[model samples]
Target chain A: MTVPTGQCCAPIAREPLAEDTAAELAVMLKAVADPVRLRLLSMIGSHAGGEACVCDLTDAFDLTAPTISHHLKVLRTAGLIDGERRGTWVYYRIIPEAVNKLGALFAPLTEPSPGPVPQPVAGRSELGLLPA
Target chain B: MTVPTGQCCAPIAREPLAEDTAAELAVMLKAVADPVRLRLLSMIGSHAGGEACVCDLTDAFDLTAPTISHHLKVLRTAGLIDGERRGTWVYYRIIPEAVNKLGALFAPLTEPSPGPVPQPVAGRSELGLLPA
Candidate 1:
């Protein structure tokens, strides 16, 4: 049987979510739900090269390399990160499309155009909650 | 002392995220991060009313009413959802501004205006990986 690897996640925006999509998103969110993962993402983003080696990560955090490796794997499986090995260390960086998709998903829901009459801000504000 | 409620979270888009913002987004993401909460957002959005009641939510899921209440509470605390007690049951809906802010943060970084006319997608693509 094929193990469910990265197939579960997709970009959050640009498509209507099926039930499977929700579950997939939940899984990705679960991967980043931990405090360690958040810190990892932050540190990686702030790194000069836009990526960081596991060796550097190990020195910054109190956790062991294996634990850091585990968190990085979680970020990788979630599509939030991509890692490459260089000699003695592995480096990881954020995946842009993944981040973009996630951003789009949480973006206010948009609706197809209705009547052609342009509405005012008040109407838009009221209608905004309606996902149009 | 005041409760550490909504102040903790801010939008993910724009600006260099201070350490506080990470924790805030983490909390907000933590809210919708749950499978049940995801379903709740779906059902609420698909609802004709653009809102949902605890009664409706309880009937939709297999979990007990109290469990549903707890989940809703979690969502509210995370600022991913807002609720109002109307009559006997409370109604909840998604907060667009909060969501918009979250979306913006995850959005690809944009560097200040610099250099000459825009380059092709290839340069943008390579630079895209680098937050320019």
Candidate 2:
């Protein structure tokens, strides 16, 4: 049996899902199934240099810093995002492999179009993008 | 103001999300954020004729009818799918617009590739597909 590993996930509609894979994906989906976390993930994934400082994320919402931290914590725990503390501020970036699993699930259903039309991102020198 | 509607959604990482949009998407995500529901959604979407009969679905799982019914109800309520009654059976098919919204959220982060590699689907003549 070929165990497909690190390939995000097989599309949701592709075949009968293995019980283990479904549970794993459910946990990840639960992580972003909130208004705050969804917005936070969007903000980070779309941010300049493909990463954002936690200090900046807190400023966007009316919630307390601790509240925002809690949401980020959930996302991090689910493996959707990863954080790094650099000096005074911590930075976060999307784990492409994690997010890609979600895409493979539902994207195949849509008719083909441009991959994803990217919004203009200002390349910032401050948040040094970590090497791949 | 050109409010984008019926266009699925602007990609999550493309820009900061509007609050209302994020909330709506969260509700839908919450529906499939379950282990059973995710598997259920996959089974239906990948099924022949792009839909599945409720009676046929229950046979695949170990749970009782009511348990499966409850999960189906959640998926239906969230607008991820639509159902129609035909004689003794109720058939369900994905609501493309809703599922597409999820794709828009996460698909963009992955590198451009073939839209979705479709799995081999055996066309069943029995599941009379309802007209679009």
Candidate 3:
């Protein structure tokens, strides 16, 4: 229930994330943590029109349609994907904002850092800024 | 026990991830899905020398030392972190390769995509390349 209300916290490599921020990200991360859900997201994101119908998605998995539907529901609850019923078939698409937020959360880890290790500043408050 | 053996796969937004690739990423993502573990990773990643001693990390949470240790063990098992015993304290550091891999996995989602939605080329095999 403690979902991130704003932009994702600064990347983990940049500074220690606040407890609440970590909790928010953990929820979304947990949503994509399962194999089936991760694949479902991928397929939806890469499909034509940046979306996939329920019929198309079920073929890629060994799971039953009901099981795939359940996984899609989980992704929807986590805000990773959005589903819309268009006539006879329901379609799903990746929520780019949600996916981008997760990418930003991990961005610092991918970039190289320059120079020596930072000195430990003691007793820093919650708002303390990491040295640049 | 499935894992990405070499580099991580192309981003999900770029193309549909192969089944084996999704399985590998899911395992690593599951490892970081917990709030406590995510916080632990952030702390180690941002700490001095890009590492943190167990003593320093324990004070940051209300959880007991053993619980913290267990979480650290999970991170280590997932290849997100490495710990070394230095005399009285155990120090943990983020594994940049692992962290970077996760970031790269999600990069396409963050960047803007050009033009219209991609066409679904029918009967494409596993090696089909995404349009550039």
Superposed by TM-score, candidate 1 places the C-alpha of residue A51 at a distance from the truth, in angstroms, of 2.0
Report residue A10 deviation for candidate 1 (angstroms). Answer: 11
lDDT tens string, model 1, A42-110? 566545445666666666557888899999999999888888876665777666556655655565556
Report lDDT per candidate: 0.59, 0.73, 0.75
TM-score of each prediction: 0.68, 0.78, 0.81
RMSD per prediction, one decimal?
Answer: 10.5, 13.3, 8.7
Residue pairs whose backbone atoms clash in candidate 3: none
Better of 1 and 2 by lDDT: 2
Docking class of 1: incorrect
Q: Which digits, one per residue and each the tens of the lDDT, describe model 2 over residues B50-82? A: 899998889878899999999999998888888
- Candidate 2, residues A7-93: lDDT per residue as tens digits? 545567556577778888899999989998998988776665566788777877889999999999999999988998877678788
User: Which pairs, if any, clash in model 2?
Assistant: none
In Å, residue B119's CA in model 2 sits off its true spot by 44
Instruction: State the DockQ, from 0 to 1, for candidate 1.
Output: 0.19
- DockQ of predictions, in order shown: 0.19, 0.28, 0.33
In model 3, the Cα lDDT at residue A78 comes to 90
Better of 1 and 3 by lDDT: 3
lDDT (0-100) at residue A59 of candidate 2? 72
